[model samples]
Target: MPVSPTDPVSPIDPDSTTGPDSTIGTAAAIAAATIAAAAAADDSTGTDALPYAGGNPYADYRHGEFAFTALTDLADRRLGGAVLAANDELFAERENLLLPEPAEFRPHTFGNKGQIMDGWETRRRRGAGTARPHPTAEDHDWALIRLGVPGIVHGVVVDTAHFRGNYPRQIAVEATELPGTPGPEELLAADWEPLVPRSPVRGHAANGFAVASRRRVTHLRLSQYPDGGIARLRVHGEARPDPAWLAALGTFDLAALEYGGAVEDASDRFFSPPANMIMPGRSRSMGDGWENRRRRDEGHDWVRLRLAGRGVVRAVEIDTGYYVGNAAGWAALYGRDEHGAPDDWFELVPRTRLQPDAVHRLLLPGARPVTHVRLDVFPDGGIARLRLHGSLLDD
Candidate 1:
C-alpha cells in the first residue's frame, strides 16, 4: 500500500507539556522515544533505512530504522520528478523565469491556479488529445518539483507535457538562490553542475533532476524550449514537515482576536486561503492598552498569538512576506508577559530575512513564554502574518 502525504501513522503525544524546568530532559526523552520507535520499526535495506512510519524518511535512508515495506512505499510516491518552466538561457528565475503568484504557491488543487511564465513568444499549436513525443515552440509550459521524502528533499523532477510540437531540442535543470547568500541562490548546494540537458524529449514521461549538492534549498528554476508540440507540465518534490516551532506553538483563536485596535479575523485579512488564521499587522495599541508608537511602516507589522495558559514559551515562527528589508533587523518581533514586562529581556533572534514576494519562515529557538507578542518595527514593512506554536512548561 502507498502512504498518503496527508496522513500520519501515529499522533504526536500532545499531553506532555514540558517547560524550562525540564525542557532539556523532555527534548532528550523525545529523541530517545523517536530512536526506540525507529529501531523497532526499522527493516534491513541495503540502500537506505526508512523512518519508523516512513512518511518523511531520514536524510540518510541507509541508517533509517523503519521497515522495508515503508521504504518501498516512500520510493513509489517519490519516484517521479517535477516538471519545470524554464527560461531561454536554461535558467528558471534569474534569466526571465517567473510565476503568476510567486509568494502564495501552496502546491495543492487550490494552490495550482498560479501560472509560470518564460519571457518567450510562441504560436499556440493545437493538440489532438493524443500524447506526443516532445513540445514545439508554440506551447509554453513547465513545472518545478523537489525530490526524495517531504523533509529530506534530494532532487527535483521536471516534465514538459506537450510542447510546440511535442518535441524540444533540449531540456535543462537550473538551480537558483538569493544573491550573496552563503550557498547558491539557485543551486541546491555547493559544487552543483550547470543545467543537465535532456535529448529526445518524451511526452508525459518526466525528466529527473538530482540536487547539485545537499542544501535545504529555498528556490528552484527550469529552462526548456520546444522543437515542435504544445506542452503541459507537472512538477513533483519533497513536502517540508511542519516547522519545529509548531510543535511547541499552541493554537489560538486568531479569528476571534483583535489587531491594530480593530476587531478582525487575522487569517482572512492577512494570509491567503487555508492559512488564513495566521495574520500580521502593526499597532499603536494592544487591546485598548496604552498606545505604542504608531509608525505606518514601522517594521514588523505582523503578529501571531497563542494560548499558553500558565506555561512558558520556547520557540516561534515568523513569516516575513517577501521583502527582506521589512525584517531588516532582528528586533522586529517581541514578546511580553501579563505585567507587560519584556520576556527574556527582549533578545533578538537572528534570521535570513525573506526577499520581496517570497515567504521567509523565521524560527526563534529558546524563546521564553509570554502572554502577548509585539511586532516592533525598526523600518516596518509588509508583514502579512505570524505563527507561534509550542508548549509553555518545564520538561
Candidate 2:
C-alpha cells in the first residue's frame, strides 16, 4: 500500500546601487557621485540584501533549496531546453514546464477540462482514485525534458509554486545522455540513471534534490506521484561539451553555452543573469542580455567565465546590440590560465570606449593560453553578447 504525502547569497558587493529609478544608467557621473556620498554618509558597507523582517508570508516562507541552486539552470528554454513529451497533460500543457516566467494563476479562469493553470498537470488516475491506496512505485505521471546544456547535473528544483492543493504527493527524477535529437519513443527505452529517488514534497514550495551522478546527461525525466501539477523544473550543473564536436566546429566562440563555456561568477544580477550573454544565438531585444543595476554607488561590474577549454583566443566581439542608452560606456577583458593562481589575471583588452547598439569585434594581439576570462564593464550597464573566437588546444 502507498503512504500519504506530507504537506511541508551571494557576495557583499558593497558599492552596488539600483538608485531610486532603475532606468538611470551608470554613466551619469554627477548622479553616481551623489548616491555614493549618501551611501557612505550612512556608513553602509557591502552586505547582502536581507529578507523583510515580518508580515510577508509570501516572501518569507523558506522553501527546500540546495547549494547547487547557485549553479546555472541547464534546463532553461532560452538555452534550448525543451519538454519533449509527457505521459499526460489533461489539465495543463507540458511546454509551460520550462517557461522563463514565474508560474501565474487566475482565480476563475476556466477551460473545458477545468480551471486553467500555467503548469504541466495530469488528470486523476484510476487506481489512485478513492478506490485504491496510492502506490509508491511505477504509478505516477512523467514528463521527458531535453537539457539545453548537457552536463553532469549537480542538483534540481521541482517548483510547485501556485500548485497548492494540486501538488504532487511525491516526486522523483532520472537523467540520461543521448546523442543528437532523440524522439520520445527512443528515449522511453533508453538507459536512464536515477538522480532523485521518490520522496515526499511540500505543497506550493520549491523541492530541491542534489544529484549524485557525475556522468554527462542530456535529458531528464520528472515523475510526480499518481497525478498532479508542477510549475517548473530547473537542473543546475557545470556544462561538459564533447571535445570531438568542438574540433569539428574549427573556429568557434570560446565563450558559448552550446560549446560548454559558462559563467562562473558575477558582480551583479539585479537586472539579468550573466549567463544570458553567453547563449547560443544573437539577442533579439534589450532584455536578451546580461544587465546590471546602475552603479550609483561606486566601482565597476565584472563577470567571470570558464572557457570551453584552455585555448588561444584570436579575436573577440563585445556586442552591445539593442542596448541604446544603457550600454556600458567602457569595457575591458582579462584572461587567466586554468592552473594559474586565482588572483593572477592578465590583460587581454585594455579599457576601450564602447558605442551603444553596436557590435564591437577586435582582433586580439597575443596568443595566451587561457582557460578562463573576465569582462569588466565601467560603472554598470547591459551587454547583449560576448564572443571569443578561437580554436581549442589539444589536451
Candidate 3:
C-alpha cells in the first residue's frame, strides 16, 4: 500500500492545559525523552534518526522565533517543477536533495562506487588538484533551485541529516527573481542577493537560517564550501500573488496557494501540512492534505486561511479524497471580512457530517464578501482540500 500522508504516528490530547508553566514543563520532558530515545536508537542502528511523530523536531528545538515551516519540497513542488542543477554529484544524485521526506540512513550499505548515501554527495576534493566543472569556478559546489512560488522568503532550513563527516562545513544562500522560463545560463547571470551569508553547519541536523528581504524572489542558489553532501532545502515565507494573473482569471479558487492563499494558523500539523489544503488540483494521496492529530477533548481542531484576495464566496468544496478511513467525522465553515481583527464572523456552513473519500459542495446562502475562511474538523482527522470558489472583489 502506498504511504498515506495522513498516517497517524502521534496522537495529541486536546484537553491538556497549555499554560506557560505547563508548556515549558511539557517541552522539557519531551526534549529529554527525545534525546534519550534518539541515543538508544542510534546505538543500535549506527544512525541518528528522530521520529517526526507530533510536531517538527527541527523547528521545535533549532528554529527559535523565526522558525515557521518550510513551504517548498517534493510534496508541494512549489517552483513549477523546478529542476536542481549542481556542480558535482559523484556519490548521490542532486535531485534527491529536494525530496519532501526526511533523509534516511542505512548502515553497512555500499554501492558500486562506495558507501551509498541518500543526499546529494560529491566526490572528495583534495585541495586545488580537483578538476573544476567550470573554468571560472570557485572552490565550492553549488546548486540552483527555482522556487515554486515567487514571493518574499522569511527563512530557510539546510538539513544535513545522515552525513556526519562528509557534510559541508559552511554554506551560503542567494536568490533572484526572473519571469518566464529562463535557461540556467540566464539565471546564473542575473544579479543574486545574499539571503543567508556563509555560515558553519553541523552534520546530521537541520540548520535553519532566517532570511530578511523585502524583494520577491523566484530562484535560489545554494553553495557549499569545498565539497560535501546536503539532505534537503526548505524555503518558508509568504506567497505574493500576481495582480495581472488575478485580473485575467477574474473568478478562481481563492483558497489556492498558487493564488497566494495561506494557512494563517492551525490547531495541528502532525500528520500533514495544513497549507496543502489550499494547493492546486486534487490531492494525489492521503499525505497531500490538512491532517490533524486525533482529539480527545470537547473542542475541535481548526485551520484558518487567508484568501488570495477579498471575494464573495458563491460555492465551497470540501474534498476528503484518499482519506477513506481517517476522514473528519464532521466539519463547520466560518468566514470573516476583517483581516487582522476578526470581530464579525458569519457562519457559511453549519456543523455537518462528512462522508469518507468524497466531495461536498455547498452553495453559500448569503452573498456577503469574505476575506478569510476557517474550517473546523470535529475530533481531528484529514481533509484533502477546502476550496472557496468565488469572484474577486473589484479594486
Candidate 4:
C-alpha cells in the first residue's frame, strides 16, 4: 500500500476500546507536528463555496478527523497483537490464517476464504493456466486485511507490483464495517484492480509496485490468488490510531434504495435514493425527493454522493416530500459558506431537466468543507434518505 509520510514508531497498547484525543504528552506533540506537515503537502483541486438561507452552519463539524492518529493506532494494534502483519513469510503450512484476536470487522460471509486468513495456498481449480484463480473465480483463495482501526482513513495503498506470473488473476481491495448482517455492511467506495496492464511476477518485484491509497476506511479486505506464482501484499492509509482516536470507517446509517440498502452493491455513482422514497406528510405533493432511476431513461432523476470527508458544505439534502416527476429541471442547488457567505448558484443537473419517475444523478457545485449534507428540494421535490459519503483532509 502507499505509505503515508509519517515515519514508523513504537505503537501503544490499550485494553480499553477508546482512543486518545491528542493530549499534552510528548507523543501528542510529535503527532501534531507530523499532521501539520502532511496537510501542508497536500495539493487538491476543485474547491467552491455556495450560499444558504437558514440552518446550523457547522452540522458537519463533528465529522472532522486526522490521519496520523490512524497510523499510530494501526502500528500499535499490529505490534501489540491486536492486528496482523507479515506473520508467515513462508507459506509452508496449509491455510495461512492470520486473524486479529479480536477481529476488527467481520466479513459478509465465511465463504470468502481471505476473510480471516491473510494468506493461503491454492492451485487453479480448472486448467493449468499458471495456477492462478480465474478472473471470474467465485471463491477467494488468498489473504485479507482489516482496517478495523475505527478512524477516518483518508487513503489506502496496496503493493503488488512484484510477483511471478503472466496473466495474474485480478486482486480486489474491498472495505467494510463489522457485523455486516442485515445489509448495509460493506461500504464500498471502490473495488477494482489497482494496475491497468496485466503483468504477473515470477519472484520479488520492485520496491513500490503494488501500492494503493483510499479514504475513510474502517475495514480493509484484500482478495487475491496465485497464478502459478505467489504475490506479497501490504496495505497503507491515512488513519487514526487506536485507544486514543477512532473515526468510524464506513457510513453512519445510510440506506440506498437503488441497491437494496446494500452499501457494497451501491454503485460509486448515485442514480437515486432507495426505492421507498417519500417526503414527510407536512410537505404536500412531493414525497421523499430522493429516488433512483429504475432504468436509464431520458432525463432520469438521480443523486450523486461524494466520498465521506471532513469539511464545510454550502448546500444541504432537503427532503422534498415525493419524487416529483420532471419538476427538478427548473430547480437549482443552493448553499452558503462560513459567516453565512452567499456564493454563486449552480444548476443541480446541467444536462436535461429531471424526468418524473426516472432515476438520475445530480451534482451540487460550490460545496465547502462541511460535515453534514442535505438535498433541499423545492416544494414539489421529495426525498427519502439523503445519504452522503467522502472525507475532508482538514482535521
Q: All models: lDDT?
A: 0.31, 0.76, 0.70, 0.30
Residue ranges of candidate 3 with Cα displaced over 4 Å: 1-13, 16-66, 70-81, 129-138, 339-341
Give one digit per residue, the lDDT tens place, for model 1 in 1-395.
Answer: 11112112222122334222222212123333433443453233321212234233222322122111111111121222232223222212322212111111112222222233232223333454668644454444343433222222233333332121233445655443223223222343334334344433433222333332433332344444542221222222223323343344444322211111111111111112111223223221122111122234423323323232324444444444443333323335545554445344354353334444344455556646565444443333344344454444432
Instruction: Give the higher-TM-score candidate: 2 or 4.
Output: 2
Model number with the top lDDT = 2
Residue 317, model 4, lDDT = 35
- TM-score of each model, in listed order: 0.27, 0.82, 0.79, 0.28
Of the two candidates 1 and 4, the one with more favorable TM-score, higher being better, is 4
Descending-lDDT candidate ranking: 2, 3, 1, 4
Model 4 C-alpha lDDT per residue in residues 290-322, reported as the tens digit of each score: 333233323222222222334433222333334
Show the colliding residue pairs in model 2. 8-202, 14-46
Q: Candidate 4: which stretches are off by over 4 Å?
A: 1-120, 127-140, 152-168, 179-203, 206-215, 225-232, 241-395
lDDT of 2 by residue, 83-186 (tens): 99999999999999888666766656898999898889999776555777556456899999999878877767787766767888889999999998999999
Q: After superposition, how far is residue 142 of candidate 2 from its true place, in Å?
A: 1.0
Model 2 regions lying over 4 Å from their true place: 1-11, 15-65, 128-138, 340-343
- Residue 42 in candidate 2, Cα distance off native in Å: 32
> Which whole-number lDDT from 0 to 100 does residue 307 have in model 2?
88
Task: Report how far off residue 123 is in candidate 4 (Å).
Answer: 3.1
